[model samples]
Target: MNKHLIVVTAALLMAALAACPACLAQTAPKRSAPEERQEQKDARAARITERIELVIARFDNNKERHVAAYNAAKARLKEAITELAEKGYDVTRLTADLQAWDGMFVKFAQDYATLINLLRTAEQYAPYESQGQFAAAIQQARAQLVTVRQDALDIRHYYQTVIRPDLQALKDQNPSSSPASSGT
Candidate 1:
């Protein structure tokens, strides 16, 4: 009888422990639908904030590379133009086109810098409470990026349409030795 009573007590204790979680769940305050929605919204905003920060970091890193590439290309073109001029080829049009391209490059760099600044501003306002400001900054940055894209395209178009053709014409005009070499 003693053994049976001990076994029954242990079983009752185990059952009570198993049911306590359900009892506590019923007593706990339930999250309303609105609260759940707000939580989801906050989680989404946090994810967007993280993405914006990542984009800003990447843009910052790419800025230096863009500047380096532009300088290298500009220098190469200038050197080529000087060499051609020394070889008695007329590079007047090439020189003008180069100047125009340089102006476009300057605008591109400026616009890119503006976009970076806007991105930084957006990062500053990425909190859910300041979503409106963050969105505005993102829009401004997007517009600036469009301007930068157009500037880059204009540079490429000018180089391909005007500069390259002029360069090819100069090469064709002086297929033989340089004037000095020809005189030798």
Candidate 2:
């Protein structure tokens, strides 16, 4: 009977020990100090660099698209002018349309440069984690860069959906559905 009781107690103790880790695991997780090391920061930066490169490549790939859109807009503008001339609409009225997006193309180009510079800066600063303040700054800049890129996409979408249709409408129902006017 004594041996049986001892065996039962040992079994129960072994089960309890096995269950303790599961119970503890239900709470906060343990993180080793290495997770907070410079290597981790560098790895994160590398991943961000890869993402940035892919995004840049995609953006470049869309260059033809962007130029095509611009060309279409210009062609429509010319058509609108020709229609107005035929209809005897004053030439100066077209100035409103021309000035609508004035300076925006240059601004957009500058914005791309700014984003590229910001990404390069982040890549450079990413591994320099010795200074906590600098590391925090790098993180903040990266976050802001994400916002900037998102804002750029939003602007592009707005142009495609809202502005392009309006320009096409100004062409007096002349649909912009051909790649013949692609090169700008």
Candidate 3:
């Protein structure tokens, strides 16, 4: 009689389990292909956002170091110019060149700021919904990065070709007043 009761209970449990699929099918709706595609796009956008954040952090660190180096070099150049002037040396050309390079450096800094702002804007865009706007921001940021890099190279070139040579000429004329090189 106990085995007969167990067999009846097991049959009832099997019958209930067989009915669960039809119950679940009605309770939970199936996702269509478009919904699945949208989910995939949203996931991709989230991953891209994370990567952009990491890039921003690295870029900021490098930018701070670059700016600090620029300021230090500018100070050194000014000190050297003052020392030369005090020693009865004509620093008119060196002063002019320094001013020009300073202007270029200022523009370079502005471009870097613009690039960072564009990346920040890109970060603010919504996943999947603002894809076009996000792409545009990224493209603009890439272009700005190119501009900033070119600006840096131009500043280095101008310093090497114009200012360094002028300073070298001054040092050649007076071997005693050896000013430190601008390590830009």
**Candidate that scores best on TM-score:** 3
The reply for model 1, stretches above 4 Å from the true place, is 1-19, 22-42, 60-65, 172-184
Kindly report which residue stretches of model 3 are placed more than 4 angstroms away from their true locations once superposed. 1-6, 19-33, 174-184
Cα lDDT tens digits, model 3, 1-184, are 9999999999999999999999999899889999999889888878888999899899889888888888898889998888777676778788888889899889988999899899989988865587588788888999999998899899889989999999989866653365433322
| Ranking according to lDDT, highest score first | 3, 1, 2
- The digit string of per-residue lDDT tens for model 2 on 12-129 reads 9999999998998988676778866756877877886787678667766664476567567756766766655555444443544445443454455566566566555655554455
lDDT of 1 by residue, 105-162 (tens): 8888888888888877887774556748877888898999888778777877888898
- Candidate 2 residues lying further than 4 Å off, grouped into runs, are 1-41, 62-64, 127-184
As for candidate 3, its clashing pairs are: none
How large is the C-alpha RMSD of every model relative to the true structure?
5.4, 10.9, 4.6
Candidate 1: what lDDT?
0.78
Residue 14 alpha-carbon offset, candidate 3, angstroms? 2.6
Q: Give the per-residue Cα lDDT of candidate 1 at 49.
A: 71
